[model samples]
Target: MTHADTPAVQGGPELAQERRLVTEIPGPRSRELAARKDAAVTRAVGTMLPVYTVAAGGGVVVDVDGNSLIDLGSGIAVTTVGNANPCVSAAVAEQAAAFTHTCFMITPYDGYVRVAEELARLTPGQHEKRSALFNSGAEAVENAVKIARAHTKRQAVVAFDHAYHGRTNLTMALTAKNMPYKHGFGPFAAEVYRAPMSYPFRDAGVDGPAAARRAIDVIEKQVGATNLAAVVIEPIQGEGGFVEPAPGFLPALLDWCRANDVVFIADEVQTGFARTGDMFACDHEGVVPDLIVTAKGIAGGLPLAAVTGRAEIMDAPHVGGLGGTYGGNPIACAAALAVIETIETDGLVDRARAIGKTMLDRLTALQADDPRVGDVRGRGAMVAVELVQAGTTEPDAALTARIAAAAHAQGLVVLTCGTWGNVLRFLPPLTIPDHLLAEAFDLLAQIIKES
Candidate 1:
């Protein structure tokens, strides 16, 4: 399907209906819906903000209550091309109309192969590569580890502290946080180790190279490079305060992995698909990871994930060892193809860089004005502001909560994450209108100033 054929972007009248709101946030209608959800859905199912969105397009979410909230968090970085992106919608619809599911494992489809080819083309590195699709980020991560183990004949997987991988047993073991994600879900998969991440804001005196050395020292001493199959990292820590490693940190780590024969896995689930300005955050540092795990924005809101890596390593897994029933569903594959095409043709990668520049400038100004703002960090559009107390670096979770609540009350949707739960992350669609982004930032500034 071509963009010219999509109603949402073809200058059709329906474009106007895409973002219209008819009620207050979680309005009476949404409340009624939420009540039904509570009765039918599992209690464990969670929500960050209370507003119930009935429709989303471009950079705004229209709630059931008729509130048009500016979406700063792209469904936690899932809707990079924008919610209900026309290109992606058309592809999905067309594929669904043709064939919803054939269980790729049973009978292959062109969409799956096309998506794999696109992943190889778009992911960083110029080496021969291969890709396998999966149903979710966690599944992708798990399979990456499996491939790493099969290739290296190693047992252990090393991950950084304060990382958020996934919810499955293996991924939960790989994840760093305890509460909410792993509080009661104990007895996780073993042979997984954690090392300190380079958090520049708190590690004041430590420079980037020094931070890398410190982390490397721990990994070498505790886990020993030989037993490790892979060292997985979020190029920019996503749920961990959007932390970007020091300048030489990633390169140094990659070099170490190369030397020690450990597969360097870049978990680009949140930072890929031009969300981080670059097509992938590793591109910023010129670091070519051995295996790259991607999801989130890849399918423009569908459940799709992929592990793209060196052909040799990816092919190490025996046939039938790395597929899921719904891995790369045709509908999702079509959407992913459209997403990749849209990012490139629409110049969203450069747009993400421009968006990041604007966000960083505004956020830095906010930091200067507010002593409570401890740090403004990230690359491209994957930006974050860490909140601290008045005169110290003490995390102010309460203030963060207050600011987020205040912003939401005023019609801007923001997300907060971090080990201390004191960081505010901005994940607006790269395609968000300039005026909406500026207004959202201005509202955030106002809330910070008032607080």
Candidate 2:
């Protein structure tokens, strides 16, 4: 059986797994939808690509205009198991048929307990762990911070530069980007601090350990260890250009957290669940955090998130301290369980590593041949290339946008991210066929050349 026929991509509306352009990128049908959306939806909601999706499975998203575009964005790294994964869909259907919700917080069910059990079993380290489920990454992250403060009896929380935590008030403070996420919103949650992150491409001379010291020094001078409750970071920065910290950076930071009794929180919302070649990005460096915030790829294309951590730290909160009305809904829990089973059974961690190799190999080659390709970095299916002026490190965001637009027009769905808006990121679903990835890169290379 082909890879696409497996649980990863099965149980979806099937279409030809090839890029086809029957209409312009945003055809008449999509334009009609866009008009309606503009009228009904808030202007604050923005879209990178305006094509309206009808069905998506196995490497392609079919548009309402009959355009089958190669999907390299994976809905911003949320569909790692592929859209409408059979395992997840089947679980959801069964659970929905049985009962949708009784509100997990009010009347707990076995599915919720089972999902927590799976998280305890799968997350790093064998230490006794506990999990609290939520409906979004923002909720999980906010809860982690609350747990940390409750355990450590501190008010200050430090997050790294170039971080993208979420959109809630507290998470907005945790996030670093200002213009889009924090522009008009002000007076964010108090006592949230920002620390410098290790960007290998930008900070050339600094190594991992030194970068850690630099950040720790800032933390000491600004938010003293006594007042700091947690230090939150992404093992691989997601919207901040898929920036992977230099070797030893995470371990050094983790060591400092341990020494200072700070709860280390890994916001693996974008890099978890085999998207980064390993089950979790922290696993690559062997730096197990005290608490890990997970979402995005947690429940295949479902709105679910989890904060899994050491039992002691997680249990510090009062029984009624952590919960939402819809937290750990039975349907979502069932989907999460199925997602875990599929990840284990399909050996998707290895598959992610293989996908990373393919992407990195192709991207680095483009970098070598073209001066516009400033840097290429990432792991597993999450890869990116920063665009720059031909000879300097100056960000060329215009060139990046042009290239991405070109790719979109030519039947490929790509995404651009980074603080400077100069990084092109690729997050193809693992269920995508090898040939589609190859074709996407080839088209990207051509677009870059033409641009």
By lDDT, who's the top model here? 2
RMSD of each: 4.2, 4.2
lDDT of each: 0.87, 0.91
Error of 1 at 103 (Å): 1.2
Q: What TM-score does prediction 2 earn?
A: 0.97
Q: Write the per-residue lDDT of candidate 1 for residues 44-110, one digit (tens) a residue.
A: 9977667765567767877656677888898899999888888888898898889999998999999
Write candidate 2's Cα lDDT for 1-451 as tens digits: 2323222222253656898999888987788778888999998898888887778987899877778899999899988888878889999999999999999877789999998998898889899999999999999999999999999999999999999999899999999988688989988999999999999999999999999999999999999999999999999999878999999999999999999999999999999999999999999988889999999998988889999999999999998999999999899889999988988998889999999999999989989999989899999999999999999999999999999889999999999989999999999998899889889888988888899
Could you tell me the TM-score of candidate 1?
Answer: 0.95
Where does candidate 2 stray beyond 4 Å?
1-13
Q: Which stretches of candidate 1 lie over 4 Å from their true place?
A: 1-24
- Lowest lDDT 10-residue stretch of candidate 2: 1-10
